[model samples]
Target: MILKDALPQGRITGTGSLRTVVQTVFDVLARFRQYMTHPGNSRFEPLFEIAMQKQLYNLLLEWLSGETTNSPDKVETTAVVASWGIFGAAVQWSRDPLHSTSEMMVHRVSEVAAAALAPVLGE
Candidate 1:
């Protein structure tokens, strides 16, 4: 469920398909998590993350280059960057088992999306 769906009174002040876009971002992260923590997985987690990150960055750059006045690209960019940052943190956490930065990244993304959704959802 997305922040807008979870918080009915919330608003989404971003571009089109906010819920769908945000959900996809979350789903990508979920796949990354599965690859990272699972035991005996054939797919290498690091390579998977690197590939995911590249795809995200490419999409973001494309969105940025588009000449739309009201672009969802900005929000998309934020979501992708935050997601990758957190993924990196998760990798570190697994290695050293120290602080958990991945969780922090999730929170940050949620916060932004919540606020962005607030206006639209409140309508």
Candidate 2:
């Protein structure tokens, strides 16, 4: 679905902040793509493992088949697959007792996203 159509339609009339939200989501997706595609980046292996454990890989197949129930159709199945890898990585790391895996993973994703978007943001 287009970003405008991704917004809540009942209580929300206009697109409001959803446009920005979708833009940010797309920017993050780009950064994630770069990270996953790079050969030197060691993050993908662990993330892929997590995705397997979480069954996100299978969900992605279903998503591609247009058999999902809740996700937005316009987001694209490949996008969901990539995002699931990132999210699964976060969950896997968060299981560590010594670190706040969730916070660290979020920080990592945000850092990559900000750097990737820096030129686009003109800073």
Give the number of the best model, judged by lDDT. Answer: 1
Local distance difference test, each candidate: 0.48, 0.41
Candidate 2 residue spans exceeding 4 A from truth: 1-75, 112-123
> In model 1, which runs have C-alpha deviations exceeding 4 angstroms?
1-14, 35-37, 68-123
After superposing all C-alphas onto the true structure, candidate 1 shows an RMSD in angstroms of 8.2
> What are the per-residue Cα lDDT tens digits for candidate 2 across 1-123?
232243454111222332232233343434455566678775665664454434433332333334334344433444354445444544445444145533445556545533433332234
- Estimate the TM-score of every prediction: 0.42, 0.28
Per-residue lDDT tens digits for candidate 1, residues 1-123, read 333343233333333433334444555555556566768664676676676556544443343334333446554555466446534544444455335454454455556654643432342
Using TM-score as the measure, which candidate wins?
1
Model 1 error, position 64 (Å): 1.1
